[model samples]
Target: MRGTGLAGPGHRRGATPHRRTISILTLVGVCLLALSATQTASGEPAADTVDTGFAIPFAGAPGYERLAPTQVTGPDQLNQPLGQQAADEIAGQVGLNRADALSEEQYRDLVAGGGVGGSREAAEVIDACARILTNTNGRPLYSHVDGHPTPSVLASYGLYVNTSGLLESPANADAPTRQVNSLIAPGGFVGTWLRNNGATHTLIALYRSAYTVQAVYGFAAQQISGAAQLVTNTREGVSSEVGMSMAPPLWIVNFALLYILNPSLAAAMPAHWAPIPSAVADAIRSSATGQVPFSDYAPYFQ
Candidate 1:
């Protein structure tokens, strides 16, 4: 079970505590503002896409032969340090005092909580990240925004928009600006790829408890199915919307290729032949179906 202390001030169900530090350069907000501006120029309104299309990544697939048993647990063990880094970065960029957002102890509490991200406070932190990912038109790489983009709001939290050298135009218009073109190509697929490999594992640490680990991992395996279904559904959606008869959407290709190539996910071996109990596996299946928060299993963490 979770420790029996005060459980900390930032330990609310949906909010993460604010860290008082910031980064040397407040780039995240700048980039978001820039993107918001560009998106506005494009004139496509904010996103109202169906939530059904937004799926957990690892739903169902084959050839997950490399996923370690430990990979399935909560992300806290690995993410605690990174989250702190993010918090610190926010603090430095905004030049705000830490006491206003998060104290050291409260920050630690949030990191220990595996970034479950559903609370009102958590929204503030995530909103900063979202602003960074979005374009000037209030659209994210994958979705549109509903309100005026708020790049300034998250500045206090260490999220800056760092376009830095990206604004430089290329020598020729026929050739694209390498930096701007990069974001246009895919939706953080490269980052996701890095995360899938062992690079992000250290930052997204596992839960120490055996059961919590199992449940968390089990849920991830099921994301393969969900991702697959999304591809099938999206193919039809895109075909009807743009009137383009292109082959499969790039997202399908990206997800499918990554599923097969992710050696760690392959190793997870979600099939029935695995030695883990059916009941435990069933729990994971249910959790995925319901979009259950993995932090619910936090009490079992060792």
Candidate 2:
């Protein structure tokens, strides 16, 4: 595999020892900080509307096919929380919720061993990523301040505000900016997107475990889902009251769309992190859904 690790301004995730036995809930808590996702079309909060200037150009670019997926006719604000809204929008034959979420049951006859490997293999990558995600753009990934809009305590159980440049605005809105509106758009960040998209696969090099490629990739894929799901769910759940959304929200309808729409995400993924099972990639590239163009992400297939 092409061995260039995550490329960006900073690239040194402390290699954490493999975590052999992390409960799903514990793993969720550990990874909740370093993740992010796009926002759903419906009920997109006034604060999170994407800047069309940057997003429009991206939509016109080679890969993006349509802003709204085939299933969504248009923006219809629904009561469902952000995470569930995104999941529902991307389900059916049109999406890969099971694959992206790393549901082992979905593996069927596709992979050898659930494709995720043992617990230690997955934990090493998770710990490495968590160390890098402790904070982004200088703001704590998890807000310790508590109160409305901004909190005064570690409020909301553990569901705190995500001020990272990934989902929220960067610390310096006036700084020289890139056309990354697609990455941070339709989120609280209206001006700029500057957070680091942690590439979990890069850790393979640090750990020197080329053999664990599949496990690393599987964990990374789950991280993408977790990052987006947790960030979207927790951030959108913020209210006058201090509490967590038992159910998080979602940004994009399909998880695959986020990779295409946000080049920054592509930059952060594994060099060889392809469709976990050939089927998912085929579906995304087949032109069947008519949501995104395979041309937009041709390199991924190759």
Candidate 3:
């Protein structure tokens, strides 16, 4: 018989086969557990399982056709220009002719007091506010004026129709020029309109007053609530999110090539590298249909 020693053939002292086997099994079990956590019970990838590291299905451009001023319907006319419709609506609200001009005192009083009564001046103020809040085509108007002007600051100025037949600032007039303060002032016409109209709650926020002809013209750009509807209902559509990380700089060139050469490959590319197709499909569909599919989804896009 061979001598029983540490190096004996039948009893190798350092060889622990059972321990090695257990260690290997434990590692395999951990890997399987991790894989299971990332997958569904049926072994399918979960809808949100693909954590690409950043938000996938990025928001593309608006899906609907942004209707021009003449395409949208007005309260008074079937399809009136946005400016004319706004003026008409303001006139109706305040009991004034659309073409009527506001006197210096009336304009001043309206801005200072807000649209309290159904006076022509109050109507003008309301109209001006509406224009500032929305554009002629009935979209939310976002302005980039330098500073936010107060109602008092606005009331200190006067509005006049210059020789160019447009509402302009007077060069040397007895009265000062006026401007719109914001979408809603305390006890002002805009605040009143916002309170009365339930639909305009989700529209754009107010901006500063620039007190320029272009700024004044922006008021006539669109109807406040109607444009809001167009934006909230029609323009913006359903959106989805995914997780992905930012791509390397070189990915841009690859993405372009993949997009041009192999659309499916581009679609399959990492969200950080390329835009997901499903995210932009609605926009493409809308471009073809010429109308936004607002009814297809919920009220807000998310």
Report every candidate's CA lDDT. 0.21, 0.22, 0.23
Write model 3 residue lDDT over 133-161, tens digit each, in one string: 12112222232222322111110011122
Clashes of each: 59, 21, 20
lDDT of 2 by residue, 1-302 (tens): 10001100111265332432243234333323212232332222223333222121111111122222221122231111124344334332122222232223322211221222323433333222222211222223332223224311111111222332112111111111111222222331211111112222222221221112211222232233211111111123431211101111111211232222222221222111011123322332243321222223323322
In candidate 3, stretches whose alpha carbon ends up further than 4 angstroms from where it belongs are: 1-61, 69-122, 128-178, 181-188, 193-302
Instruction: Point out where model 1 deviates above 4 Å.
Output: 1-35, 38-86, 90-284, 287-302
Of 2 and 3, the candidate ranking higher by lDDT:
3
> Which 10 consecutive positions of candidate 2 have the poorest summed lDDT?
1-10
Report the Cα RMSD per candidate.
23.8, 21.8, 29.4
lDDT of 1 by residue, 1-302 (tens): 00000000112354332321121012223323433443322112223322322122221111111111112133332111123343333222222223233334433333233232213443333222223321212222221112222121111111111222111001111111112222212233222332443334311221111111222222222222321111121323531110000011111121122122221211121111111122322333354331212223212221
Q: What TM-score would you give candidate 3 relative to the actual structure?
A: 0.18
C-alpha root-mean-square deviation, candidate 1: 23.8
- TM-score for each of the candidates: 0.16, 0.23, 0.18
Global local distance difference test of model 1: 0.21
